[model samples]
Target: MAQSVLHRDPRVDFFRGAAFIIILIAHIPSNWVAQWIPARFGFSDATEMFVFMSGFAAGIAFGGTYRTAGFWLGTARIYFRAWQVYVANLLLFFFVLVLMLAANAWLYADTDYVTQLALNYFLDDTGRALLGLFSMTYVPNFFDILPMYIVVLLMVPVFMALSRIHPLAGYAGCLVLYAANYVFIFELPAEVSPDRDFRAWFFNPFAWQLLFFTGFAMSMGYLKLPRFRWWLAALCLALIAVGVVYSRYGLWSWSDTLSDLRGQLVDLRCQNWRGDGADRCYFWTKSNLDVVRILHFLAIAYLVVWALKGRERVLTMGWAQPILQCGRQSLPVFMFSMILSRVYNVLMDQTERTTWEEIAFNVVAVANLIAIAYLLGWLKSNPWRPHKPARTPAPEAQGQAQGGARWGNAVPAPGSAE
Candidate 1:
């Protein structure tokens, strides 16, 4: 994909970091904070934001590799990053298992919530479950996102190659596969527990890939993110308002009895087929990348991009730097947060906490997440990567170096090596 150039963009980081935080809040079951996330107002939630930002970052990072080196090098870098994500997933799997087992042992040591948290397989059939975990077939309820990412990263080379030739062609392929998946219900295998049939992957890479590339392509300059328009924003917000009401009610099933005007809510049935309910309304489902979810996310992203256009500088301000730092170190922050959030989950479960206690727990967890981000940011400095080669020597030095041995009209002055 061809973005104008590789350069730091705080807007991306700012939102990326914000997405991680949103994911954390949402993942924590029963956390009141979850209600305020974008999902409450629209069909799409933090996951789209996370994946879009992932693709956006990837386009910038690997696009540079493709440009500086060549297609093969760029492809290799894509695989390498995929390998890293896979490794992180593996590490996370073990971490989750250990945390669950430890929590079980300490609390009650009697009844088990580890299974409640979806680790029954590990306890019942350790060997097969271990195999499934390694194969990425047995994803815990909350740990499936990484596997989706692993699949996406593995496909980046194909996206890059296609986009390099024709951006539309690449996205065309993604669109075809996504549509086919919806048509055929194509899915990667997943077995959360032995009792149930192997279920399809929750996120459906075949579908989510469309969103991923939409972001990558947008970032790569293949597709321009539409400039914010008042009509569009208002429409989006109006539809969002309808969604909010639907959420507040029971999908508007009760609206008919409300004795009030909720007619526009009916328009949400965008896929209504003749008189069929779906034809008239848009359904929002994450697995199939439903039109409602897709448009909701696009609208949200457009608003963010437009609103933050000239305000990028604020992300770096002291007040905003925590988010900026976390965004810059998204992967590590993400991994850390998942683990931390689980720990909080166990704590929430093991104790009878009051509302104040829950709020305090969330606050402390967020602070800890920020501190981890800070540490990750610091550790990422230089030592984690090989030192860059020094800049080319000056022309006069190059000439002298070519002369070798003794310098012109000069001899080795001391015992020190020349």
Candidate 2:
């Protein structure tokens, strides 16, 4: 990978930051704002965007290290990041659990918040659930993203090694794994149940890795995106329009009709499969990263690139700064948003679900995300480091320095002569 190819692009940050906001909205149940998110508009959503951007950023951040340093060093860095994400996941789960417990205790609400999150497994069998949680077995739906991410990060070195043999080799490996996901149905058990009724990780890393490595390959210069063209943009627009029409959230009057069509397709296609076939449309299976989602995301991503190509300056404008900053510190921002969404869900539950209340609550939630992004950025910058003022030379020293300059023996100030 060429170092030059790995330079930062502002558009990556812009889209990624925007996706974080969308994910926040989508996670909070009954938020009307979620209905208007891109997922509602199309097959793909922020989860795809998040995973793809993670791969792209990982390439930019670690690709050069693999090239300049040895393979072991690069692999070490990747695992260190995975460890960080693992810790964040644990922290988030416990914090949210505690929050819900406290709310349930004090609010006198009739909601069993733990059961709402499908965490009764933990309550019913703490020992088994704790073992499952740490071992990445009992991955609840809401908490699956980070576990998927951690597993993906661990696979980076494997792909990096394949890429060393040839770029095609790396992508071929990715495709094989992706296809094998369907053939083998490889997935982590999401429940710690003793019976045969077992659940699996929502975002299946084996299947989803195709998108991640696609972004990775592009970032590492193994794959190159075609420059924006008018005809291509038109095609992308047409695809997006089709996605909107076909999406479950589209066409209020056709919702039931579309639902039936999807159900028919799932029954026709998935029921006969040798492995476990989920009772839903395989074409829109978020867990499987179906082709429909892949194509939809590609179309949306290309059109976005076309829209931003000559107008890159817009990302640096006043209103875009908060989003850009959130992208820059995405891990912290995403973690904070996850924690914040729980509070928003609790508050929204108490409200009448009016338009004004929804708008107000969502606005406050976004504001909180932006504030945390900036705060985390500042903290990561090591702002508490002591600063030393430059010392002024004494009168005699100044005179000697002046004499040395005249006599061609003066040393230049640091970076002054560059």
Candidate 3:
């Protein structure tokens, strides 16, 4: 019998949506409401979850695409998608840059607008415009992930080729790269300049590639490691325990002997810290592979998969569908959410409240996010129902293309399907 795969994994969608929520909460300026939940619970940094899922989703999306479309066509599709992301990012950069300039001029007339403009050079129209067009590293902006995505897309051909020939060797290559990254790249001093002077150190593709390639390998059944659902549960518990210990008593030090050795090897400053054994708990938060974090996330992810197996109804209930929809079209949703977040930040800055009001602010923020998400969902469902332009296709089309024919067919056609 042919092996089966899930077209829409509720667990993945729920976790992805939850990740976005956490990211939103984290970005909310410190308020009493936000602080009520302890940061250690994983609310402080949701970026790791997002990035990891991005890789995981990439595996599910592109790996399937490669199988169906074959290597060359699959590579082209990925490149096109990456290029679309880059283009969208570029447009956003210019839009934000212009707004920032106008705000500086009109809003901060008394202050040194020129100085402010210069300081935000990367956020300026010309700088962002250049970065977007060329995919060059011009600024230390969080939005620069577009370039990284593009670079990773470029690697798809190589990854695909290796996967076709020897999936184990391909995955092993990814593992070796990850190991080298951990020992040499990640261990290097924080300030070590990449050849591009682009803080490639911070955005270490080598390390992140492991997550992406692992997803790819899994999709291809290259690494036939036993699927230990129960062990995954244990791993999750262990990670929680480690996180709790680290948060409570782990000491953070950047001057340890290990740091010195690492710093010397890489010719950069080293930050070494002693965690209460739990301090270094969340690997995703590190944005680099920490063995503990990697193992923990893997465990949690597998457990989630096991739990959600054959449970489709759980994903179809009440608000769950919309959230899953958001997860399905994650890239666009992410881009849209980022734009909304930046707008929210600007609005919050304008308000300038000193006190953190948790209940009130969170209530408003959550409501707005959900409302926006719902609106986006509605648009997705009914893109051409007379009011909206038929020009832009529903985000579901994008997901379908990535997932292949079966899943693609599941998406209701514009008017009749939903």
Candidate 4:
């Protein structure tokens, strides 16, 4: 048997990096950039791509360790990663809170930053709110994504263990958990509230795990992607077109007829899933990873995968370098972007927000994000560490190397390990 080797996939990083940019733009309130994000064109947005790519990365990072190094070591690695994400969440929350407070105190803005973010829970009951924040029970909407991500990472170990028993077992578990979300109405509490307002996290881990693990399985070779065919491509494109027409942010919102048709179809789907009085469900819901959203995203993913197949070299081009770099350092970039979005929102509120100002703001914001990503990448590389120069071979050693090469020994020369 041969040991498996892992190679870096630019496709994963490219898409993930692109997702970070979209997320950053979308988070900022009333940013003109938001109107042009991919969410405006389809039912799904960058969130799906981000989560799926994360799962693929995890599979490459940890799944192989589980198979070769055994389950315990892999589980430990997953725990460490989850801890890192958890700490990042805490830092991001505190940093954003400080930013909001500063904006409130220093800027004469009409919007109450604290109230806008629904951070009153902390001010009203500091002790309880602290407990909930630490326990992940008092998640504000802005900070909910990381909590959901942490929970999903923690689930990887369970699936990895199940996979050892039977390849399909873990997949079954994913489906069961996804189904349980709708059937049993299972979701983690996001806030401690007397009323039902904002009860659960904006993204439900159980429902969303399906997308993550699908990527995981595909990356780990437990599942295979469908073969690309002309018919399949056409089907996916058609589905995406339907999504565009059905999407409120898309063509459907422009005309009453399309809007009514979408509503009726959505209501029918909702009734089929949850009985007649299902709170009048819409075509897309972010919190539970609605089926329509899942389908639309999958269709897009299939098409994109095929369209970009064997063209991964494009990701290495100069134009794509910024996105590639951001994807390589996605975690730090994400945390930075989260805080940066708040800063942008505050600045926008303080400024005139005219056409020219909005254009300048978006351009500067993107430049800042790219700059931070490159800075983080450099820091993470630890350039401050002392470099050890390559050792020069002695005359005898050089002679031996020459002799080995003459005899076809296949010995690698100094500084030529690769």
Evaluate all candidate structures by whole-model CA lDDT and list the values in order: 0.69, 0.76, 0.53, 0.77
Put the candidates in TM-score order, highest first: 4, 2, 1, 3
Query: What is the Cα-based TM-score of model 1?
Result: 0.82
> Whose lDDT is greatest here?
4
What lDDT tens digits, residue by residue, belong to model 2 across residues 1-418? 1221222356667777898898888888878888788888887889889888777767666665576566898888888888989999999999999998877887755667888898877888899999999999888888999999999889999998998899768888999999888776787898887963878899899999999988777766777777768898888888798778777754634778767876675567556455455543452478999877888898888877667766777877998999987887878788888888888988887878798898899999999999998988788767789866745532223322221122122222211110
The clash count for each model shown is 16, 0, 12, 0
For all predictions, the C-alpha RMSD in Å is 10.4, 10.1, 8.0, 7.9
Q: Mark the 10 consecutive residues where model 2 has the least summed lDDT.
A: 409-418
Q: Write down the lDDT that model 1 would get.
A: 0.69
Question: After best superposition, candidate 1 residue 410: deviation in angstroms?
Answer: 49
lDDT by residue (tens digit), candidate 3, 1-418: 0112323545456657766665556555444444433345421234556665665566655665566567787788778777777777677666655665666666633434234323344434554445434545453344555555655666767877876777677777778877765444443222222332334334555666776666545534555434555665786777665454444233213347644553463332123333244333222335565555556566555665556555655776887865666665566566656555544544555554445534445556656666676677677676676675435544433433343222212222221111
Model 1 spans > 4 angstroms off: 1-7, 108-111, 192-195, 248-284, 382-418
Report the C-alpha lDDT of model 1 over 267-384, residue by residue, as the tens digit: 4444344454332222235666776678778776777667766666666688888887778787788998888888887787666767777888888888889999898767756576
Ranking by lDDT: 4, 2, 1, 3
Best by TM-score: 4
Looking at model 4, the pairs that clash are: none
Spell out the clash pairs found in candidate 2.
Answer: none
TM-score of each: 0.82, 0.86, 0.70, 0.88
